[model samples]
Target: MLRAQDLMTENVIAVTKDTEVRELALILTENKISGVPVIDGTGKLIGVVTESDLIFQNKKVHIPTAVAILDAFFFLESPEKMEQEMKKMSGVTVGDIYAPEVISVQKDTPLDELATLMAEKNIHTLPVLDKEELVGVIGKSDIIRTIAEGR
Candidate 1:
């Protein structure tokens, strides 16, 4: 069986959470990648930033609907909330859009298991960690390549 380390991308491109959304989007486009792992000052995996996160910045609207009305009754919707979302959509940094709850796998993990995990979680990528330090990243494309090459 192939291992995560065998197919993971070692030359991983990462960014800091404080990076601007515009810059992050550029990085993703330049690198031809959909997402990037967000690191902290100490180079620790703090979150995962993706194109979807950045795209959401262009989708903020305060038009109240039925869902908004229902949420308002529970104090879940307010002008302040809309303002905050608008701010996030406009001037928010990658830190504001990153998904802090990241999923990862060990470098030596079995590829079969990793694939299963990916399917179950509906995730397209997984960071490969060695003792909590990022060593590589594995994506569905990598898995396909591995299968095609019989690696």
Candidate 2:
């Protein structure tokens, strides 16, 4: 059966938390990739930053609704949500917007399981690991390319 190791890209383009937003955008555009894995000084995967995260910078912040009743204001929505949005909108570096929770696959993971995980999670890029070591990377394009080549 086809596995992650069969189709994954061995040479991966990645970023660090200290990477600036402008540089991240340029990397994405120049490399023609939608996202990249964020690694630390030790080369350990810590997060995933995507185009969606960068796009979020332009998203309008939604103010929480408050209902004024009897001279008392009661917020109908959580104000924390608005605070989070504001923080995301003001992000200047990958560390400010990258998703810390990452989903990874093993080298031996079957294609069906890999596809299912990506589909279910709505993930465009995934890190492939072997015993907690990054081995390769697999993106949606890889799967589509495989189908096109009838692999």
Candidate 3:
């Protein structure tokens, strides 16, 4: 019957939108954590940035297939997807590439619900919130640690 507050790691490491990608990478490497929460100037939780965002920079762009008929051209795939990929590929800062949708849990959230949300969404770092304020974070590693330690 554990709740998020039971095991969530306090003293969260967070970054602002303007933080450079290189600095963010260094932070993750030095801390040995996969990701961190992104906060705004007001310290409001705005998003979560992870290692995947960094990796996205190196992924090969899959150009959408297109065909031409009459006097117009048709794209077999979504051009918007390609545009998004290109943007991420050239991102210089956390603001350019961070996942803006904040998938967070409150301190009192049940552990089971938190686990389920993470599994379903494939989230690695989940920010723990108290109202609109950033408080702590939970990660997949935390869940694994809890299980392995038989807590």
TM-score of each: 0.81, 0.95, 0.96
Candidate 3 lDDT (Cα, 0 to 1) = 0.93
lDDT (C-alpha, whole model) for all candidates? 0.82, 0.93, 0.93
Candidate 2: residue 115 Cα off by (Å): 1.0
lDDT of 2 by residue, 1-151 (tens): 8999999999989999999999999999999999999999999999999999999999877888899999999999988887878887899999999999999999999999989999999999899999888889999999999889998
Error of 2 at 132 (Å): 1.0
Off by over 4 Å in 2: none
**Per-residue lDDT of 146 in model 3:** 84
Candidate 3 lDDT over 39-139, as tens digits, reads 99999999999999999999988989999999889999999999988988999999989999989999999989989999999999999988878889999
> Which window of ten consecutive residues has the lowest lDDT sum in model 2?
79-88
Q: Candidate 1's C-alpha lDDT?
A: 0.82
Better of 1 and 3 by lDDT: 3
- Candidate with the larger TM-score of 2 and 3: 3
- Lowest summed lDDT across 10 adjacent residues in model 1 is found at 65-74
